[model samples]
Target: MAKLTDEEMMKMMESADNAVTGEGPATMAESNDGIAPLTVRKLMIIGCGDGGCNIATAIARKIPDETFVIAYNTSKRNVNEIVCDMKVYVTSDADEKIVDGSGKSRAYSKDAFKLNAYKNLLETVNIGLEKMPDISYIIVCTTTDGGTGSGSSPMVAKLLSDNIDVPVLLMGVYPSMDEDAIAQYNALEWQSEVERIGVPYFVLDNNQHGMEKPKVHAAVNNQGAMIASLLAGREFGNSSISIIDNRNLYMLLVQMGGRLVAAIDDARPSSGQTLDDYVMAMLQKNYQPEPSNVKGIGVFIKGSRELLDKMDTSIPEVQKKYGNAVLRFAHIENSDSVEIAVLLTGCSEAAPRLLEMKNRYDDIVHAQKEAASVIGDVMSGMKNLLGDPRSSKRRGEAKEPDISALDL
Candidate 1:
């Protein structure tokens, strides 16, 4: 395709602006130059549990026509409550005979998926495909600390990755330590399974969000929706400054075992703030203790040409800081204000948290084994003291006189 000129780009943005303000159609009409207008990419959002469903619902609400959303859970009630294009209730024979929660058992959830959920998923995918035949991406959302979400997510992601032609993205929410020990264990196990499945995933740490349960849920959903919007939104402009298409996004995000982080700066430029200073400040506010193992960086800037020019100079500093990591850039002209979105891909700093959870899980298992051993020893001692009636009878040493004297 030919590069777009600055004037053309500005017109496209104006069209988008008009669309957003409801003054005109959201999509641009075909230009006289024979250039087709930008269209939102179709997405399939498969939510695995309550958390996933919540995020999916938020995304659906924001981009109802662009996405097909579905929720799957072992709990019929939970699945019933989610608002989505479809709901898939996963169940096993045991679940059908005696309905109960997975009791936070990752094993139970995995079994349910292996025995029953996969079929439902296939059917759901068929229906979704009928609605959105041109779907370009699949996003699997789940919390990695619960039975239904943690256990089934990896399997679901793997199935989609293997069967579908499009790239699959995993949006995983890590559990807070305060939730439950089982949750920690589940997260640890789920991480290993996800790694083995080898799908790219984004982690949202519930512990670090610093919100109450309800607020955290909303925050997470909003963040997920924002990321989805960024990926799906058009990055084209008239100028050949930089653009991130769906392929660019997929390449940046599909690095196996990489954690994704996005930082956004929406504040007005202060009197003394340079574009570089603003970008650095945004990074500081969003990224905690810089990741040393960074592998890729994507920078999206929406600002005036002057600010973008300033950003051009700062790119070298970013490259220097990240060392040899790959970098991608996109610039969109917006006269109202400047904004930056930074996406980083690398080995996550969540290793320490995972290790801690693993250690705690090991400690619990050890303690349980020790307790069982102690209880077994005490029971054995009591049995020895009482003597074995069967052994006594076999040895012809059984006694029968003591009860007769008292009864008659």
Candidate 2:
């Protein structure tokens, strides 16, 4: 398909915005039922790489129709393959083509984003916001190992945060340890950039899930989508004693130090099972180091009113375990079963893999420096023996070997 010019793209987006706001000739469809139309706050999911696109596609499938989904990449193949509401390719100038089949060159990817990709992204997001004035959240999804995703996502997040009014949530996928050194290095670099950006983010460790290489991507994508859906306060239609609306979700996510991790347990209550037991189990099973120094905690309970009341009382005890972390509660009523979902923010334990990756990257750099020094010494010795102008060797000294006489 022919690429749309910038002017054409802008016109198309403006037209869509007009249609959405009842200012254009096009009209919105009527609701099927006699019930009033439900007004939902819109969410924009922007995926930055192959892994990110996978997660965004999964999320688009699960989120409400009002949610906007777009995927961005420098690779034409990846852009063509991903399923999203929009696909954006960050093409380079004719003189500078940036293509790495392995997706390992982060420097090139960063250049691509800075040169023109970010502008395109910002423009597209502005158009989306115009169409859906209720869009209060922007979720930026990317993997912290590949070239385009890792190199550009942090900058994109920062750009969105600085230019847009909404809260930008970063969903970073951590690469497995067994991946190549370049990926590890890229992950470390990307983490540093994200830390500098100082936005709220959640880390999904691909290695911890115990899935095989071939299946892990899909698993990661599905899990991320599920968490995002829940956080967006979408109703599951089960009985609810209390509701956590989208505004409440926005408040929880917009807190300072937005490093977050979550866990969910859905099981019938046993004789010995307690709310404390569920909370402890989630902390131990889902997160590393138990996430100390938390600033906010969100607990969503699905059970009977009695069970919900018990959990509500247990919140104080849970807060005590985390240096008096502030708490938010959501309850749903369901008989014969209990479900717990935990979202912990401002946790240092959120991105332990980033620390490991940084250490690994340092070691790799040290090794490379040592190797380069040895090569430099060897080259100096060769130059000395060859009698360079600075070496001052006598004519009688042995000369360097000449292989020109050897037969092919």
Question: Model 2: clashing residue pairs?
Answer: none
Which ten residues in a row are the worst by lDDT in model 1? 19-28
- The positional error of residue 241 in candidate 2, measured at the CA in angstroms, is 4.2
Scored by lDDT, model 2 comes in at 0.68
lDDT (tens digit, per residue) of candidate 2 on 211-324: 687677776687678677766655333332343344335545664355777767676556666676767777666523356667555666766756755554235566677645
Candidate 2: segments with Cα more than 4 A from true spot: 1-40, 64-66, 95-102, 235-241, 287-290, 312-322, 332-338, 349-352, 362-408
Listed in order, each prediction's TM-score against the native is: 0.73, 0.73
Predicted candidate 1 versus true structure: per-residue lDDT over 7-41, tens digit per residue:
75455445433432334422234445554444258
All models: lDDT?
Answer: 0.67, 0.68
> At residue 302, what lDDT does model 2 achieve?
66
